[model samples]
Target: MGLNLRAAILHNVTDNDQGQLQDTIVDAISSGEEKMLPGLGVLFEIIWQNSSEADKKEMLETLEQGLKR
Candidate 1:
């Protein structure tokens, strides 16, 4: 069940069958739409809640770098 949930969540990030939604998300994030940061926060919360410590640390570093921009 958890695995399925994880897949579903990540599919939004990884799916490429359609381009617009993913492109929009990327553009919004790159443009620093402050509202979109919370979406990233929610995604991070999901990962942090379920991932191993090493994975969480890796993601934390990535997110920290992104937030620094």
Candidate 2:
């Protein structure tokens, strides 16, 4: 099979604590590297899958607001 970026990102960070995860996210965003986007998308996908409908709505609202800025 071909390399799975999402699976690789998940495996690499599976053991990360909350602080480590936060740092990783902050660093990824601050770096502004296009290559890091897939990893962030994987993280967001995991979050979306686990989130409740209300939580998803709130996230979508927040995303919309951010986009408008």
**Candidate topping TM-score:** 2
Task: Assess every candidate by TM-score.
Answer: 0.45, 0.95
Candidate-wise lDDT, in order: 0.69, 0.96
- Candidate 1's C-alpha runs over 4 A off are 1-25, 61-69
Candidate 1 pairs with clashing backbones: none
Off by over 4 Å in 2: none
Candidate number achieving the greatest lDDT relative to the actual structure? 2
Candidate 1 local lDDT, 1-69, one digit each (tens): 245655554676655444765575677779897867755665667658999989988988997999999
Per-residue CA lDDT of model 2 for 11-51, tens digit only, reads 99999999999999999999999999999999999999999
- How accurate locally is residue 47 in candidate 2, as Cα lDDT from 0 to 100? 97
Worst 10 residues of 2 by lDDT: 1-10
In model 2, which residue pairs have backbone atoms overlapping below 3 Å? none
